[model samples]
Target: MARDDDTLVQLLTPDGERVDRAVGPDGVEYSVDLTDAEYRGFYRDLVTVRRLDAEATALQRQGELGIWASLLGQEAAQVGSGRALRPQDMVFPTYREHGVLYCRGIDPIMPLSLFRGVDQGAWDPIETRCGMYTIVIGAQTLHATGYAMGIAMDGKVGGDDGEAAIAYFGDGATSQGDVNEAFIWSAVYTAPVVFFCQNNQYAISEPIERQTRVPLYQRAAGFGFPGVRVDGNDVLASYAVTRHALDHARSGQGPTLIEAYTYRMGAHTTSDDPSRYRPPAEAEAWRSRDPIARLAAFLGRQQIADETFFAEVDEQARTEAVRLRERVLTMPDPAPDSIFDNVYPHGSPLVDGERERFNAYRKSFEGSAH
Candidate 1:
């Protein structure tokens, strides 16, 4: 898992040292200036998100959930970019963006309901400015691109008040057609969208090396846009780079690709076993450069927060996790007939016919174990 640091924008080292500004090999200088309180807030977010992810993983293991996608090591990448977003911005996320969803003011129970098979995520995308979790690979990029195109057509680009869109995907998504199509459309239409790719080094059991020979960010240049690589483990770097990219897009500069160099640190989902395909040594190497640990070190060294503060945050996170677990356990399942809901805006004859057939089929099995 050794990476070439020459092209990576890192504002905080693994040991907690801060770099005010650093120019990557791509000549992009990344920096961030935040108040002490804001720095502490970021730490709280990282810790809390990690705790929630762990709780969800445990829930899945205990048969409470169908599956859980743990965002163990990518806390900094998600929180940093998520916190960097303006209230006016829109976000389209892959299924694993629980941290970003949390940052978007979504309750943890919303996603839990989805995995629990209760109902689709119980949140309004318009109100939250975040889309529902997209389970299909790379499809959200197209949705985001289309949304950004609408923003552009509506004259919502260029100026401090302008809006933008951000699409989150994994490194494996870069090889998908929908993602590339998004890149092409966004670049051509000058849509105000940023493509945030968290290159977590593996696509399930497939290593990143098998996905592509060139760096992911570099692919943006081929589509006529700027690209940058950032230390995904460094919250400061992630925040700065994402903020800059968002601003560039809002200013009518079109698209940018951000490759967040990081690791999964857990299974792709609760169903997959990372240990089967990932080496223990590789996992150990990434563990040392953990996103949360590095941020905590910086906060402690700078005296922005102390052990007592960390303890309180951990306690708060635990309390929240407990509450979420209770909520998931108590959630009511949707009505059986609800499956046919939302198939069409008004009503579809085809869907109505299917619903009738399904109801008849269910009626036939009534009071029968067979």
Candidate 2:
């Protein structure tokens, strides 16, 4: 897919029009092919995922979670890119890629364990093909780059069956030295990785303009790779563009930077106050471009989905929310000793010493019980 330079690439519009295939100026055709049912499924995924975020945020407000990162407006950016990945592809996510986690077949409740202050990360990264959410700003870029290098070292490049990795970060992360270093490594080694930056218009309280003078995707050129910016709110566009990038990387084309230009419609997290840093009108503007609403509009206009289908999805989402709420409430508290168990794989004497001390302290209390 050749990217049009003048504007962000878009296949589905906010007003419900679907542009299935369009020829770029270079004579390359960019298209999206999905059955009506598949399109409706995307709509349902968006709704259900958004509902999941909303419910998680509410849980945080009620003290169920210590803090929650709401992926309110950026669902399309995450889900679109995530669903494009093959099963062998591994995902390195920041703390906010809940939509991607859903696409990766991870239990939505798993990350809650981290925020709810129960466990570190409950899922097996190898089994799920999704790494645990990295909380550090841009550290996962390095990890993803190293993983991609390993793929290359293992001779897993230049083929359709080759394994690839992707690192998901925000536009703000582009400024971090770790991200820059990762780019250099990826470019030099021609690592099979995709650097996906969801430029959600804000990096916490700061704006994207504060991060870079040029668009985020263009930065990839400096690292000696191709980059493209897409309409992050247009799920079809995001999915198509990401699929192309991933295929390119898997085929030994090296790294591609995809800047999903979208917006953050809510607070940075449950603990954040976007109202202080953001204006109401700005959010109102993005509101009209809501990802779920746009897809639903297209589905409705095309007669692909009816009121009954929407009703069914809504009901399903409600049931999911209820079940999730119950699961969260009933989450067992982590064992006191479990924390030390995961601190080291081979075992660290410092950690072992601390664990023994704690065990002795507990035994003292037990001795008093006699």
Candidate 3:
């Protein structure tokens, strides 16, 4: 059977057209419906996510954060899939997924603490249904798979009650052994988890071609589950596809793989320079397909919004930027003893020993005359 790379439905094209693909062997016709309000909601999601990205980048440059990852180009991909998740669903994310964190009701400030070198993670995962943004590349996938297995064992799967797990990873992480092992575990146990991979063309300085020759969605077939690719820049398509896949998993249909085709318009992090690895022309080309601009254009063409409404959104975005800046700048540094506090729940013998030795050293310094 021939799979449709173009079969996955995309309501808003990069050129801003309302079109659909014919059904093919892959069942590519859109399986979900959305309202005009929902479309506008997607537009809002993209805007705020971008605003947050801009704020984080500025914070990094101002030295408020040790480093920051800018998700300027992949806003649609993250927001689309993120909005699909229910409040009960748990999400494990990579450090770059500030968009996902925003969708999960976590304050944007939560991530700032990690980069500010103040604390490990500021938000409580159980409270927000979001995990700490894992910085170790693909390692969090295994944790997600384990959580899915626990969910299944608790009879959370095969129900309409809204419990599922999701793991967010990047193109660069696709090569990690942990990600592959997660596939094996999730498939064998039929875990109710969704693996959302944002293939933004480059994995740091390396291109996607360096990772895999085959389209990533095709990899799921070998793992014994369904896989689909959607225009990551098309927030509507991304939301619809992810909602369908999560619905499938929640109803005991097993895991689904989603490859969101998008690009990273900014540097990998504040410390890296894109000019060294990417050409100016490539950046300029992706800029033309700016996900936020495309959605704004579509909303205007459909009369879903007017010039005044768009101006409001732009104003609101700037306001958000200012608010984030104030909060980030005013954020207090964590106390010195906070470092050893969260390392253990009760206390570790080694930790206790270290604290004793450190206290003695400090006392010795106090006794010495300068």
Candidate 4:
């Protein structure tokens, strides 16, 4: 079946500048006039996120981490949308959104601690305005929807210059029942939120076509909200679409859905072997359309940045990588009893019993060991 082409909104092409008369939403056209300072910030965000991801992957390979998820090619998608969010807007991210978490001022060490099996969450959700990384796939959608409902109830959606909530999920998660329910609730109640779906073509080993008969964005209409697809590799386009959707949500126009069409150029996680399921050619194809390189090319061609700037950014990335490696190596492992401490706010008798038993069992083989 032929899909609807008009549903996609792209302000910047990979080659730079707009082609095909691609317009953003009805009001407040998106800006491509990013000042040099803004461009430098974008460069820094991309470099640091990539470095953080690489460091995590290295830790997993070195047995410092139990597992890791690499967001190699999805940097622009995360950075663009992440930068668009206001300080007041909350973020609900899937596990691989380390880039977004970094942009939101959450420490990158949070992911490392979780992967090292030392902590459930190293960052405070309320303080960072970023919820815990939801590893259970699309379940965070409901949590985000509920949060948006509370925002609506509190009359926070339509004020403060169009502040709104945004939820981030992967392409595979679109099939989850919780995500669909979130859409239904958000649409029905007119929740002030945007569903930012990064359709990176594959959900682990499964491709997007296997999960949906139509484009993912089209699914939003069945739930009574408009949807638009943007070039996820184009940071400018991603920022434009998200800003527009968030503005719409903030204006009390109800929730909006944005499908960022991009590709994931790495394994699903460090534990998975992509060669077993994905063709090398497919990964190669997407690699040529690398999100970071395209942006660099655009900047260079437009004379917005030169080789010296890139060299400095690369150097900064190396420094961050070194720091991450050192931090991961030195992170203290949580005591066995730490797990029992946060299970219940008040307390749980069963947990207390288990803790005591475990302590006694450990002491049984102490200094007087056989």
Best by lDDT: 1
Q: Residue 349 in model 3: shift from native, Å?
A: 3.2
Task: Tell me the tens digit of each residue's lDDT in model 4 across 287-327.
Answer: 77676777777678778889999999999889988888898
Please rank every candidate by lDDT, starting with the best.
1, 2, 3, 4
| TM values, all candidates | 0.97, 0.94, 0.94, 0.94
Each model's backbone clash number: 0, 0, 0, 0
Clashing pairs in 4: none
| Regions more than 4 Å wrong, model 2 | 1-5, 22-29, 361-370
lDDT of 2 by residue, 1-370 (tens): 1133454778988897988765432233567888887898788889999998899999999988999999999989988998899999989999999999999899999999889989888889999999999999999999999999999899988766888999999988988999999999999999999999998988899987787788787888888998878889989988988888888889888998988889989998888999998889989988999999899889889899999999999999989999999999999998787779977779999999999999888778874755
Q: lDDT (CA) for every model shown?
A: 0.93, 0.88, 0.84, 0.83
Task: Go through the candidates in order and give the C-alpha RMSD of each one to the true structure.
Answer: 1.3, 2.9, 2.6, 2.4
* Strongest candidate by TM-score: 1
Worst 10 residues of 1 by lDDT: 1-10
Give candidate 1 regions above 4 Å deviation.
none
Model 1 residue 148 lDDT?
A: 98
* Model 3 local distance difference test score: 0.84
